[model samples]
Target: MFFALSKVLGFFALPSNLMISIGLVGALALFAGWVRLGGALLVISVLTLAVLGLSPLGNILLLVLEDRFPKPAENDNRPVAGIVVLGGSFDTIVAGARGEVALNESAERLTVIAELAKRYPEARIVFSGGQGTLFYSGATEAQVAARMFESFGIAPERITLEDRSRNTRENAVFSRDLVNPGAGERWLLVTSAYHMPRSVGCFRAAGFPVDAFPVDYRTRGYEDMTRPFRSVGEGLRRVDIAVREWVGLFVYRITGYTDALVPAPL
Candidate 1:
């Protein structure tokens, strides 16, 4: 129930979608001869879209979340017990249809596994992801990632696919139940940099302590604060991603899915 409601509300929560919705309603109002209300809404919609698209607002918003958990420094030789890669990296529908691995913008989340696998040859590799789309269902992310991992030369024996997780909370809970990490075992949690805070919070709440291995960074650094996107679509997409993460963090915290409102490195 919560999942369905969140999915529905999440659509309107995106600034791009919300602005378009306002514009549509405004057009309908104008057709009905409600000039004052219609004009106000239309102006609001256009102005909001312009600000979100042309300005550096999207980059600025994303930088906050991207900078929350800095990617762990390299050269650490600590023994790793496992590596857990969260979902949202692959285009499962396309992969299923095309008979190949089709990765999205978050491909780094999965691609980094190749490097990690070589670095920690004995570490257990776990891919947690199920069917995330509300209507479409075909090959799961884990199924697609399996093909990719095999292409990366990772042994099938070392891979564990938890294909039931549909969200970050589920990823944490399901992966923990599957791995059952020992007290001293070190595990790395891999996901997009902008999503690390919420992912870490969920893992922590699930009693799973894993070091953050943030990948698929959307921003360079603080310098990106003033940098604007080249296109409206690109800018709006960035804003949507950043806003969704912020909203997810808030909702997860309030719902007790995570204890931290903004999870930090531990």
Candidate 2:
């Protein structure tokens, strides 16, 4: 139920969708002869679009989330029992059709996994993801990840694929159960930097303590303020992702899926 609601609400929450919705409301109001109200709404919509697209607000907003978890120190030599990589890295349908893996913007999730696999050859490799789309009847993300991992020279014996999970919570719960690490064994949770807080919280909530290995940063740091906006479409897309992640954190905390609104490193 949560998954379905999130999907429907997510569409409406997108900046583009919100703009269209407000415009539609204004159109209906004008048709009903509420001229002032309609005009005000229309103006507000345009201003909102400009603020989100032309300004650095989107990057600033994303920076807050992205900065919550920093990249782990490269020199730290901790014993890792395994590495768990989340989904959202591949287009399962495209991969299934083309007989090749097609990574999305979050391809760093997989690439990092490959590098980590080589760094810790003795540690287990787990990929968690399932069929997340509502109607796409194609290969699961885990299936595609398995093939990709194999291509990266990670032996099949070292990989554990949890392909039944549909969301972040499921990723933690399902992967924890699949791996079932021993006492004092530490696992590294790899996901996008913007997504690490929620991912870590969910893993801790599921009784799986993991060292965060955040990657795929979307923001260029505080310096993004000086950078020019390359495209309005890209800015809006970043806003959408930031908004969804913020909402996910809030919802997860309230529902006890996480122990904190924003989990921090210990």
Give the winner by TM-score: 1
Off by over 4 Å in 1: none
Off by over 4 Å in 2: 31-34, 226-228
lDDT, candidate 2, at 160: 93
Count of backbone collisions within predicted model 2:
0
Clashing pairs in 1: none
Task: Give per-model TM-scores.
Answer: 0.98, 0.94
lDDT of 1 by residue, 1-266 (tens): 87788898999999999999999999999999999999999999999898898778878877887888877668789899999999998888888889888989999999899999999999999999998888787789999989999999999999999999889999999999998989988999999989999999999999999999998988888888888788888888888888888899999999999878999887
C-alpha positional error of residue 135 in candidate 1 after TM-score superposition, expressed in Å: 1.4
lDDT of each: 0.91, 0.87
